[model samples]
Target: MSTQTEHPPAGGGAAGVAEPGQSAAPGATPRQTLTLLTVLLAVFVVPTSISGTAVALPDIGADTHATLVPLQWVVNAFNVAFACFTLAWGSVADIIGRVRAFGLGAGIYAVASLASALASNVIMLDVARALAGVGGAAIFSCGSAILSTVFDGPARGKAFALFGTVAGIGVGIGPSLSGVLVQGVGWRWVFALHTLALGLVLLALPVIARRTTEPRRQGARIDVLGSVLFILAMLLLTTAIVQGSQWGWASAGVLSLFAGTLVALALFAAVEKRRDHPMLDLSVLANGRYLALCLVPVAASFGFVTMLTYLPSYLTAVSGYSSGTAGLIMVLLTLPVFACPMLAAKLVARGVSALTLIYVSLGCLVVGDATLTLFGQNVALMAVAVPMLVTGAGMGLSAGLVDGQALEIVAPEKAGMAAGFLNTLRLGSEAIAVAIYGSLLATVLASRMRDGIGDFPGAGDPATVANEVAGGNMTGPASAVDASARGDFTDFLVRSYDSAFHTILWVLTGICLVLFLIIGALVRTSRDGREPSAATGSQAAG
Candidate 1:
């Protein structure tokens, strides 16, 4: 494979896989598809592994006497490492061979899982989780690159859809599966299962890479300094976001982190400008069309993250549902996500821009969320199901479409870098969205509760009244409380919570509507960028 020419064979050596108009040996059996699938699936391991651990937090704390902040870091450690390294690993895979790099990541992930399973303390567990993040970065980064390298045209679209669908399912199922596994046996078994999956994937590697052993010569050098700067910038920014609620947002530590992020980011750009082969090619972002495509995920992710972060609370607090039931309700949002990618793939094949589909999906989400806000209590079970289905479908469609399309735009040699760039933006978007939108919802909920209670005549001593109402100990009708006599005895907390949720939904709708307009504009440009019908057959005619 190395003896082959350094450059991609004319119409061959396509990104992820061979595509129409790309070079390929005649009658070549597709070898990398399943390999790519396995790699992508490996990305789910951390989520699946750690998800079970969350349910065991109380047990863990009881056993280890872990403090709240330290215990919280157990989760944040993985998130921080995973989000920061995704692009870095993507870039590294581009420099090396994707398979070799991905396999290495899998090995690390497997070992880390085992270590975490056997951990005797919180510090050790956090260390193992961070290591798993490092491995996760490798898996996710190259997974996308591998898919892009192995498939082309409509096939590529469908492959990405499948990948996204599976990812959504893995995340959704993780907690439940983990809980069940932990109950039936123990939490250690969760990580042990990952080791088993790792072994299987490793065994399949040879077959998966049979036709893809050729090393790509990208003539690009790794910009290590730039990567370091980027890591710092991301670390500071993400840390600030994650800790601001617990820490005083105005504290010097938080302010210093914010300042550090800006400085590191600036330094990263300067360093990359001087590097021969930068870890991230900032030029890709200069393309207006690409920038617009990038915003599609960044903007919509706010709502996606918000829903995932806050909805469970809604379920438990207001809907009177159990934690398990709340988990099931969330499935309404994630289950449909898996199917949307496939649908979007079909739509993309039929002259639709991927961005258009993402827009449609987001629009659907806005509708579903709005419906829930306005008539959530009044709607029947089937009616409730309708919005959830729409939300899930929209998420599915939006998740993977741009990824596939973005990879398609770049040359085969640049696939890794492109993948890294896209993933970096996306992961950052999701993290920021989760933090920012979550805070927004919190603020709104708190404000609404404060204002609504203050206006209620006899709800004296707001904090005490709220505490009593929340605890479900308040007696007498909520409306029966006379202005003068209802001191600290009001009982309409659920209704107040509902009103706050309603306000949040309206905000989401407004944001989605704006995104829709932007998406519509981007669709026009994306359509123009695709190969014309005449160019689709035989040679791409580039």
Candidate 2:
């Protein structure tokens, strides 16, 4: 069969095969249409969840009286849980049945959102957000599996394309919709919005489940120990980042969290080495070309997703936009994601190399991030248009291409692990990037607060005020100022935030450029020194 027509055979996948009742027909049936829509709906929401809630952070902090440290959890917990549990959920789907897993995940997500909506404390909201993340993991992992069983051949490709598109749309619209929800209905309504959509998914679950089936993994043991260790490592690492800001970075508690993360990761490696069915096949890391390719999404995570998480806060706080306006402006950054994946694919087909497109993307990210320093307290839509579009385009170009291209060079048996690891790195890096950025921003804001503003009566603590300001609660500083100096104080705060924002963006630019040099050389040198596979899509792309 041509590569385009190929589809998986029975018992042919790591996730499991479609069972007896499942159709292998080439065209879509009403049942299949329903299944596809159901799966796509779930797919849409997961990425939306990842991107949306960041816009509501200011409201969340103000309402809950949380500082930036715990407030960071509102975003990090979701990313951490979703990234850590993704592969494990795939294993669970194979055992419990994909449809059952899908329904269960949707249920968990709905309940968690309800809890998030009702939570009066930031801690309660953070925990619920993490639960939503776990549910999101199952939704995407098994949602893909379910789609495979319901559609066949050409339609399968279309289904997956739509799957990716809907996901992008979800991400593209999440901030804006979330902003509107926060602005009009209040931040709690953001979680309530998810509850409403997911509730409908649950209503259709029984019908969706009846239309498909997959064989159970009779004796398959999930690498539970490996999963646990990975989760521990991620949780510890993110905790350290958030805490290093609130506590001194050199504090023993912060140091201990860092130490604990390293130990957990070391143990995870040891556990994976001994597992019969390791969640990750470590051997793939040796392929320098493959490793280099995986950095495509890493670049996107650091360059683009971090903006998704932080920029709304920036626009609202430093740029003096309302949350709704900030969300609308963010459309410039997210819109490219909706269309660029297909454009990249078409360019590749037209004889442009995927690796070239990847390099171009890195260029866009570095240039865009650096140029985005144009944003100031008087930010105009026109001033940010070019940079936001460039950054969004950079991310959009590589969203799905990297996965397929990365898998092509490795042995077929390793593809699943290769993919699982690639995505984990992508997501894990995103979570860390958000934490690291927030931590850096917090540190900068604090220093400026103490030095630039000086100590004023009723100012509270400089560090506490910085934390509050970072969470978009400028009232902390405002409360300290006399009415006459209030205008000057707010202006100074904006300047402080602008400087910090610029510093972070420049640092991120340096990281992107350094990575491009390192990975670009690795791909070129490694490809020349290594044997060419029957698949040199890497070479052609390189």
Candidate 3:
């Protein structure tokens, strides 16, 4: 069967797929609808696993008797694998068919989820989560490529908006759902539920979508060396950042990891430039507009996504809230995620420029991060809620448009590679952000706690006490010096956390400001200095 490239316009057309004011092609509606549903379900599954599993970390730790390092790995292992493999999968999807790759990925994800649920140890759980990330890479890489290929013009914008909304729901509701599961049933149910949902998606995929292939160069080869080098670089960098506090920043091991990362990155760039069919088209980076599109998400991941991962931990550990209460508080951070994407889509469809929206979003992020620095132990929930909403709105606006905008400039045939590259930056930066943020928090909290505990009688080893406090074990024997010291230590723990949180917020605020200026300078505009119409249907796809 020949592949159909002509999508129905936003208004009613030959294709029967009814978008707003549009009609689908004859016999196309059902397949189009099913394809969309499958992608949405696949997209929703991965992020839900990410945020939901974060909420269940405490439970996972308790049940597995995991230490701080192993617990961090449980989260980072997934992130690392997801980041490392997305670009590789994107190329693989293009060489094979997107639908086939997506199906295989869904199968892998479901199996890994089942394994995660049945894991008897922390190591086993980490391994399962990492495998799930491999699947997540394929799903994320192909999902956008498929959507980009299937939809065009205003329909594409609307489809991505709906896609963003689904993603928002997953990010917003996952923690709350996980809280319910962890509290009412068990943490294991979290993975079990994902397994069931994805299993169904896998079964329905073949029926919903037709197999389609992209035009590929006859001698094209996957850049295996580039992939290996990039993965090694990311692995070493992430390890150095995550373990810097524990290993001591100046220690030989941490320094060697950092050095190795630099060397690997250099080698990867060298190899990619020499290859005819590079995993990533480095030429894409030369385009200022595309570079901005790619890098903005990296900055946002540092400021926004990192906060999403850690805020729940803070709410439960430092603020003395239950996991359920923490989830409720997180709603403030996620609700706008669902709302802003649709708003952005409507605005773009009405001739508003995506560049303008991106600028506004980044501005919100800067303001939100700066505002969060003002929070303290006595700060009201509404205070945190306000900044979170602003940040969430920023995330929502950009998340929907960034991928679409990046794809606008790329050739349709290279859609998979572009999508993979975009996500590689997005998720890779997120993984690094977690490490950097975690490092800063650990280092500052330990130092502050050490100073606060200085000269306290019978407070054996300030480092040990600090570790216990940082780990949220405030009532343990390590933290209890005596009756009189207990109250002081409690006060110190709260104060130290406040200090660390403030420091992180301030640093993120700086990052946001720097990125805002850089993006403003880099993104190209029309001769009149107005935003370009590329994000709308005005610009033809390459």
Total clashing pairs in model 1 = 12
Q: Considering TM-score, which of the candidate structures 2 and 3 is the better prediction for this target? A: 3
TM-score of 2: 0.78
Question: Could you tell me which 10 consecutive residues in candidate 2 have the lowest summed lDDT?
Answer: 1-10
Worst 10 residues of 1 by lDDT: 533-542
lDDT, model 3, position 356:
88
lDDT of 3 at 393: 81
Cα lDDT of all candidates, in order?
Answer: 0.68, 0.74, 0.76
| Candidate 2 Cα errors over 4 Å, as ranges | 1-36, 53-77, 91-104, 110-129, 144-161, 175-220, 349-351, 377-380, 407-416, 447-451, 454-465, 529-542
lDDT of 1 by residue, 1-542 (tens): 22123444322346332432343332333554565557766866755654456766666677678998878877788778877887788778777777777888888888998887798998998898888888877877787777766665566677777777777777677878878877787767877888888877788777665556433435767778888988889889889988876664678988999999999999999988777778877665544455565666665565565676667776666667777787877877787776777888888788886656766777786787677663343445566777767766667777777777666555555556667777767767777776765555556545656766656665555544443443333453354467564544233566665666778777877776787677567546445654222111111212
The full ranking of all candidates by TM-score, starting with the best, is 3, 1, 2
Residue-level lDDT of model 3, residues 119-229, one tens digit each, is 999999999999999999999998887776666667667777878788879877887789899999999999999999998788877664543323332356778899899
Tell me the tens digit of each residue's lDDT in model 2 across 67-175: 9779988987897788877767765665556778789899999999999999999999999999999998878767766655455544544555566567789888787
Top lDDT hit: 3
Which residue pairs overlap in candidate 3's backbone? 11-22, 12-22, 12-23, 14-25, 15-24, 15-25, 16-24, 16-25, 17-24, 17-25
TM accuracy, model 3: 0.86
